[model samples]
Target: MNKTLVAGALALTLAGCASQQPAPPFTLTLAHINDTHSHFDPSDARLTLDHKAVFTRLGGHPRLLSHVNELRRQAEEAEQPLLFVHGGDAWQGTGYFTLNQGAMNADVLSRMQLDAMALGNHEFDIDNQRLAAFIQGVNFPVLAANLDASHDPDLKGLENLKPYVLYAFDGHEKERVDSVKDAGKRPVVAVMGLVLEDMPDMAAHTGNLRFEREVDSAQRTVRALREQGVKQIVAVTHLGLERDQRLAREVNGIDVIVGGHSHSLLGQFSNLGWADGAPYARQFTNPDGRGITCVVQAGQFAQAMGQVSVTFTPDGRVSRCEGGNTLLSDNVFYRDIRRGEQHRLNEQQTQRLKAEIASQPNIAMVAEDPALRAHIDKQYLPALNRAYGEVIGHLPQALKHVRLPVDGSGSQIAPLVAASQLYWANTPEVLAVTGRRADFALVAAGSVRNSLEPGALKEGHVGLELLPFANPISLVSLTGRQVAGLLLETINASLPADAHTGKFPYAAGLRYTFNETSKGRGYLDRIEFLSQGHWQRIEPDTRYQVVLNSYHASGNDGWSTFFDSQQAFTDRLDLAFTNGKLTAFPVARLSKVNGGGVQVHYINQPLNCQDQAVRCNTDARAFIDYVRERRPMLTALPESGVTLKRL
Candidate 1:
């Protein structure tokens, strides 16, 4: 009621309003890596040492740790909010993973102090049980937004796996009186995980853990986070570059994406006329058009690290991004020396850059962290030495990949795989069931990761080459129509994959005349199957027993044709080949070997898929067994004894 008091109160209110300000811009440095793939040891990098280019391996857990530690220190000095994250596939690909079954990588990654990681398909290579154990071992959050693991007793309640986490780094939230919409305190970051939708096709047994569509899961998650008043959102994904780009375009709330799984070297890849791409990070307009989204990925094998520097407005929109792939590659620097780029091994420009390398600075290659190296050498190498290096056999000649393994040509490994599968199909037990020998075996090129090198091939070498996916061997019955369809799909998968994709199917006891001209899954000109001792043109209605890896038998890699017409999207199938007749042994019934000692196994049994559990997984075991018993040494290709001709 007093005029003086009212004036005083008004003045105080005005003063408080004048002092309040809008929230200042926040900057964050997001460091990302993907697809380390059990490459515990450093890679052989090409570098310049002693004034000349030399081949040296770089990148191993030791250097990876060292490289990241140095970067963190640099980031701390710059006073930037830094977050270290992995995109996924930390398991499988090397002897280190094969021996420890990912436990070793888990401990090593934990030491790296990751803020978070997405679940890669390889994480499920073993089974849900092992995946649960791996999740338990790591200290960081393991995320998969679409995961539903409630049904399995081991993964119930889903406490161990989180879809999205309201994660915070070393940063602070503040009050912003200047803007009513921006006035609040929240954590520094919110990272959501989205894995590949193709996990069912990749893993033989995922145990009841189901994956929802990434976009659907992401939409729901973003809404939930936004409702909770969190602004900054990052999607750490294993969906690779193409899908991640699509995600950036489609998803509303995601600000940045750190991705993996295609092993794509986004920005750092040499444009060798292969797949060309933009530099490490690219910006896309959001689907809602409210903001811009940045996408980034580090190349596979821990050989490089992606650093994304982002500035965000108070409302969580990205202002700008400065990000690129840092080649921590200890391999030499020649990859950067574009062939005609003013400098070559014989060029004068080398005098300047080469001198820099020859001088005291000595072109810095990420030195292996002594502590991490010691851990790997002392604790890890023993198993690797015992399991991987022990000589399984000696090779007389190098088994070079002559052709792309896809389309059933290019690599000796393809034909060799067919021969190996055929041997197993013809084994006494399998022969007794179908009352006939298997017509042919189906093998997809992607299944083999590496080639058999010449010299004393070690058991660990085989494990690394084949990769340890415990996928079982399966026998299925298919009519000639289905088999022919499969062959066509295999051819269509061959070309673009001559060096990239690996869905091509190779066969033994089967030969096909392919007409590349007809195009689009109908490329097959003719297909033949081996009969009692001769090759016969396959009949469309005739049923033949086929031996293939369990992954394919279960209808993956474009082979959905394997299942009967009635079944689609079916899970946990124990499929048995029942109806139809084989031309070779049409008269013979189940469990009876007709003539020629070729009895086959028929299915009265449900197709319960089980782990082969050999010392080594993949066909590497069969390759080893075939080598020891049959050729003891490979002088040339087609060691499986089934060479082919195209008519």
Candidate 2:
């Protein structure tokens, strides 16, 4: 053979081998928000600055959309693949959801151009039929691989509700690169949604849909995607941060997890008096021990946006992950002073704080998107304005709401809320119906969505924003033992301190001590009852008249003890705003136990509005009336209501 011919053949062989080599690592960017909970307007957020509390506003859909759109523009200019998603809980946080239901959510969210969304547990806050309607109304597909909606007539075979959504990025035109077939031989990215397997416990109206375990569902989905030649996998999950980490560790082939449900602020913010959760985009070692999965979650209530840029190798392992949660806020800042007046921050101080915020990776001062803001103003702000205008009371001091009690102190406002319920129960009309005044009232920590800042308290703050759920006040009788057991069951359900913290209990007219080392009685060491202005040990055999929100009264949110004890009792009564009057009636009962032992019930009984009786309202109404009439200043309790002891 000629020498030149042999050399040319060798060069061609080397060129063919190079073509077969795996592709270089590619970059993809994601802009995400979770647990937005219908915050279409800026919300009050407090941060410590210069040893003083600075009141400012954070997020809202408009601001969040601005941040996301800018990021998308930047990514498009850079010719990088990008996606925007919502982790979950897009409904039921503010007055908008209270008034407009899912219509407003679908309309506003559809405008944001989301690639996909996780079917958050709150989406089931209504029912399967309503959820199906919302899904149909939204432009983006709602993904939920673990959900088997076959039993639900409305959800089964729903066109927009999918197990997974696929995307493929070509060299340019990021917006047009959704189909895998369009990009021949290019890597496809699969995004799947995973909700809580025990979703019915958190959301009562999930209907007949069944939730499979998160880990098993994720693994199965990833395996299927891998077999189909999809390399990059993202799980947009409603599982809290802890569960996301667990899924990352237990499962294989997951590249990233965009998580919600815990409302975790997954970045450094402790210096501002905020919880510095685990760093955003932190990689967890996969089950294979070599592959890496990055997890990211923005804080709740439309307060933050999570922007993550990931570098993925050919085999779908996360090579490098960056980005953190950015808290979008307005330029305004204030401090409370004498006579409950808000002192606006000076220009110099505002500039200094803004400079500091700019230096931080997790906070951004962004202006609201004008078009979205205008749309909200035209379509939604009228009802919210009316709701916010009604001043219910005033708070002289700020009260923080921490779900898990720390240093033997629980939520300041939760106790106040419970006291309000107790006040309603003791009202003459309510007492007459119950045949006696109530002993105490208990409310879940989750029921109180926000802390009470020192300011003019509005009716919307309680009814539309804080306790926005339509839960009524219900009265029940329980022995001291059952009361103790109820507390234990709820506290244990919120255990591990990282997940399900919402179920932690807070009370008024009662107090308890928790011992960490004591396994006996599920860490509840002591129980006390307030009697004649003195604390006394509760008598286990004594039947006490207790007032609780209807949600807990029905055993939702892991309050199984409430359901177990009350399910068989015919004495349960719910206080409702019937015909504009507060009236008591028999608690609604389900025909039978459903999946997860949840006894679904509804207030379907017909009532005569013509009957002569004093009308009253429940839930937020009770709290509003209590604040306006009983304690406008909202002072702390006489003594700490909780004590914690460690081994």
Candidate 3:
């Protein structure tokens, strides 16, 4: 062996070792938004800034895009690895969605250049075909690791709807590293997506697609990625904040979770008069107890954006995660100079508030993305404006819709919705279909999307924005025991501190006291039925005719009891009268079909209506009629429908 040969071989071996060495510590800046819900324009926001109540416009898509683009620019300047993603649910809220469907969503979101998005349950609000079309239109991947779409023809083999995507980021360039072979030993970050397994309970138009349990799918994906030598892992989930925390606790290798569905705004915003939430980029101990998993989410309706920066060790352990949520606003601000009127801030107050806003870490006054704003204005706004322009009626005072009972009262708007359903049931046309008038009406808090603002109300406000689902009115006969079971089951489902409060029940001719800390058989402290201008404890044996939306009748969102009891009446449902007699009548049953379609059937023969039989009563029509009957003004019911007491 010569000296020259030995030196050359040694140098070659050293070079090989250097090439195989572990990558350096990496920092990833994650920008995320969630539950935007088709709010293209700014919504009204009220904030208490510096002990002064003020009115201002808060986030819209145009402003959100501006902030995200700025962050992208900053990340590019720093040469840092960055990912921008949507948590889920960018559909079905305002008049834009009602008029344009998912076309507008696909167009707008594609332009934003998202890396990946979690599949939200509301995405299934339309049929499988439309959902497939929306997914096809988007430039980024629509992800759901738990979804099994093999059985559905529309979503069976989508190129972009994958379980996970891998990215390899070098100092100067970031490339989509889809395969382990493609990655070739470079440091890789895998972003996996997980959605709710209980899809049927939350969404009505899922088709043949089935969802796996979120934790199970996440664990499997993380393990697979680890086996493939992908160290850094991010899970984009639509499982809500608490579920994201649970996923962080249970999943071993995930470093961060960008979440939505519960629409949690993760940050301290109490100073801005917004509800305070868990701190942003909060870390949870992984299953191994040594690794850290950070969770973050933005507020609903494009109101806020969350930015998190995480530093990871070579072994994929998060050393630190820190970030905050910023509420995007415009410079135009207002103050309540008079009791009920909002006045534009003068130069002095405006300048002072501007200074204060600058000092706040989470409030960012940003401008709208000019191009996107122009696109919305030119392409979509005119149609929406004309469609929603007609005045329906007026609200003398604002009716608030709180999901959970607060300060001893439940939603002021949901009860109104329920009352409308009951009122429609008593109308001559509806009475011809069911032989009897409804004893009470039930509605879920989620059914009413927003509170009713005082002033001249428009068709767009009620029909499109407030009750956008447009669920058909349904009639069901329930015994007192069955009704009690329905209420108890739904109440218990919404009882968890982290549960989706949208399932909380509100009623028209019913009222109950709920003990939040109850350990008894059920949470109901007491239940009563309003009858003949009097209140009485409902009898267990008495059968009552109930009016509810078809969505609830099909047993969605913790209303399984309704389905189990009403399944027998798919044909002709028997109605019970106060005279202790049952009359068999042909009942109208509405069933959800493919592609956001509804299937209607009459048990025997169709009811005789003066006009269209099936079109005699609809959810929106009922509300419209009630509003017309009330005339010049609409107000909340005189009684508090729910009394919630906590220990």
Worst 10 residues of 3 by lDDT: 574-583
642 in model 1: Cα distance from truth in Å? 16
- Residue-wise C-alpha lDDT for candidate 2, range 361-432, written one tens digit per residue: 678899999999999999888877786757777777777788877666677788888888888888887777
Of 1 and 3, the candidate ahead on TM-score is 3
lDDT of 2: 0.81
Residue lDDT tens for model 3, 84-186: 9899999898989988889999999998889999999889987889999999999998889988899898999989899999988865257887776797766
Which residue pairs overlap in candidate 2's backbone? Answer: 581-615, 581-616, 582-615, 582-616
Say which candidate scores most in TM-score. 2
TM-score of 1: 0.75
lDDT of 1 by residue, 1-647 (tens): 99999999999999898779776787878888898988778654445444455443446677778877887888867766777889998988777887788789888998887878999877877767777888888888888887777776666665647887664444522221222233334345787899877666555556666678888888899888888777788899997677888888988878899998767666633321223445566889988888788988877787777788999998889998876765554423442323233333434443454455444221235777888788888998876777765565677655644323323346676677667767755766435644446678777766766555456766666656453564545555788998878776655654431122456666788877665553233356677887888989889998877766766665565555754331432222222232321111121122212110112222233322242322213355556666666766765554322222222
Off by over 4 Å in 1: 1-24, 44-54, 169-187, 271-279, 331-364, 395-412, 423-435, 452-454, 464-467, 488-502, 509-538, 565-618, 629-647
The superposed Cα distance between candidate 2 and the true structure at residue 634, in angstroms, equals 2.8
Ranking by TM-score: 2, 3, 1
- Which pairs clash inside model 3? 127-595, 127-596
